[model samples]
Target: MPTKSLTHPVRTRASRGDIAVLYTVHLDTSHPTTGCDVSPAAVHEEYVVTRVTSVAADGAVTSVQDTRWSYDNSSRSLQDIPGVAKIFVIPQDRVDVEAALATAGAHTYPDTTVLRPYATMDEVCDAINPHRH
Candidate 1:
């Protein structure tokens, strides 16, 4: 939702190609962590990401899409097949996604570090060119 200031409404929204980190709580099908349960009804929590494919006219980032690539061997000799998935995000699923080079997962996934929403012009420039001082 867009917040209203004294002058006008300001919306901090994610744009297309923007990647976002998620401290998600989902079923522990893989049980990657030690804290996760092995049962089918297990709960799992971890940091993941999804690429923003679009934004609404009201500047609401309600949904996103992520693509997974697989090697195609049947129809294609040697080609990458992309599988896209559209994900729906709720209104207030705020996880303090504080994406600053971050206490999130910068060191773990440097490539994913550029996934933060560029809220300011300076931030956008800095993220695009981190060495600019």
Candidate 2:
């Protein structure tokens, strides 16, 4: 039998004609701390995908916009994946994220650090929305 993967879904604030659902998965990693017989440290990472579906009063889905993001444990922050920014849905939040990433230079992920921003949600939505119409 194959193992089953679990995902959690959260409802986002919706407008009169649409309902948004966010689905999340947690990823875990363990690495040895130091020295002989030292216990490993467990780290948790998150991946989130959201679907904003436009619906009619009869509960029919007319359109859907999906987006995704990943958490960077070393930076202790969320990072948007390329072409998927609406998963966060805020512009100022990205500014704060940049500041946090800058201050997190002291931290290393496997001896290196990398932080960058993906496209804005509006850009992503615009690119994909054309296909839906």
Candidate 2: pairs in clash: none
Off by over 4 Å in 1: 1-11, 29-41, 69-133
- The C-alpha lDDT values of all candidates are 0.34, 0.29
> Measured by TM-score, how close is model 2 to the native structure?
0.20
lDDT (C-alpha) at residue 54 in model 1: 55
Cα lDDT of model 2 by residue, 14-63, tens digit: 32223222222322335545445443233332322233334446543333
Could you tell me the lDDT of residue 19 within candidate 2?
Answer: 23
- Per-model TM-score, in order, reads 0.31, 0.20
Q: Please give the lDDT score at residue 95 for candidate 2.
A: 26
